[model samples]
Target: MTTSAPEPVAHGVGRVRVPMPPGTGLPFSNAYLIDDGDGRVHVVDPGSPTAEARAVLEAAIGDTEVGSIVITHLHADHAGGAAALRARTGAPVLLHERERDALGRIAIGVVPPDLEAWGVPEDRRPELLAAAVVPTAPAATLADQVVEGALGDAQLLDIPGRRVRVIGTPGHTDGHLCLHDEEADLLFTGDHILPTVNSGLGLGGPTDTNPIADYLASLDRAAELDTGTLRALPGHEDPFTGVRERCAALAAHHLRRTEEVAASSGATVWEVASTLTWTGGWDALAGFTLLSALRQTAQHRELVSRRRGL
Candidate 1:
């Protein structure tokens, strides 16, 4: 991975790509340091739970104080380092209020899906269940990570000089958010949108609303931004512009997948997922990959069924 020095995006906004732990299947996740127009800096998505990751973020913060820690979502690769940083700086941790509530209800670990219900073959069930050993929260998540505080939609952060407003975009997770800085024309999108990868949906655990539906609406909210000039600093990958076109492309991709799900109306999620496209082909999916594929297919299937009133 190319080591990046803290690169300035705007006058006080800088992007640091924190390397993810090996085996995460990705290169790195980004952590942004936004000068609150005061002496302190506000950190966004501090990245992996690894000490090396925290060190990278700490180096970016240097001697400057950390005013607040804002997480885009609770995913480890995104918010994992929050606890350590918060402890070090005594800075309050901020996330969507819904995510704060989720922390209270956070399960001890991820519960394995019902293999029979998803129609996984009996032989495949054991391997999939084994992968369920993963935790629902970051391994380093601490009790202090609890309160500290939270974020709200349309709320402007207490950055004295910058006009950073929170835009609630709840698709990737129930409380996923993107920060829009009208003053800087920059969007700190936390997995809400990416330049290349199609981020998986419904990762934030069970919710009453359809994650697919929530995601589409969330995309619409982001599309309303001044995309012509707004540069998006995504949770992963390099920073990029063309927010509007990228939004449309992401929407179209999901819509196409939805259409594919609709066409195979009567199929089980496992069957439907097999017919639809996957990065490595259906036959190659196993364990957690297979589980994720089926769950996503189920979400699309549910969306289609809901629309049909079936």
Candidate 2:
């Protein structure tokens, strides 16, 4: 497989577009390689764990030492290759503790009753139930991967000449993190805030808190980045400027969903979701995709109800 070469983003930042598995909606996931100018590089979000992608990454680094592997979250598309990369590079792996917890839950798999709660029809239930049992065993899951260090919010990384701050933006996943290069005024936004597409909340795993609420708060947290000269290097799209505007747009997108959910007339989650508009049309969605839509619809309805005391 011929892999694409890394594109230079800035003085030391490089973007590697990792190809996703076939049929996945997106074209590719972006993995950023940060060279600290010390003959060592840090790999951020080593996209999918495919031999081609790994080869491309290995070739890009050449003889440079990979000192650290930082995961923005535990989602397979983003953190899937961390373990493989760590094994090859011997680099210390770091991620938010909460991301580890979510991975743990994924290992356990979703239960049938939990699927039942989504109000899916009996005929459609089996597909979702089957999805709970991840085809590959638990050991292959991202959460089960080794972690050399745990990150905390506002903690400064000791990367040479780089003042990288770990911003805990937990809405896309319970432990999603964004790396802020304070010196360069760059924000490495994993799945938390993408350049396009309203990233789904609670997709990481089941959470104790309302994901919609967490997602909104996370958006506000992302908005704190001073926009004077900030550029966003997102996980899935091209590098973009105007971080503040993008964050606000994400927030407004969710607000519209909340209003739609609140106004929808439905006795069940499925009914409410069917009434609302989906990108591919509600009826066109089926299987796990439909399940995700219903799940998100229910969550937004819950949030709106809580806010209005309805």
lDDT of each: 0.82, 0.78
Best by lDDT: 1
Instruction: Extract clashing residue pairs from model 1.
Output: none
Candidate maximizing TM-score: 1
Lowest summed lDDT window (length 10), candidate 1: 134-143
TM-score of each: 0.93, 0.92
Model 2 TM-score on a 0 to 1 scale: 0.92
Which digits, one per residue and each the tens of the lDDT, describe model 2 over residues 173-263? 7888999998899999998877777776776667889887898888788888856688889999788887788888888888898899889
Model 2, position 153, has a per-residue lDDT of: 93
Instruction: Flag regions of model 2 displaced more than 4 Å.
Output: 1-5, 132-140
Instruction: Report the alpha-carbon TM-score of model 1 versus the true structure.
Output: 0.93
Q: Residue-pair clashes per candidate, as listed?
A: 0, 0
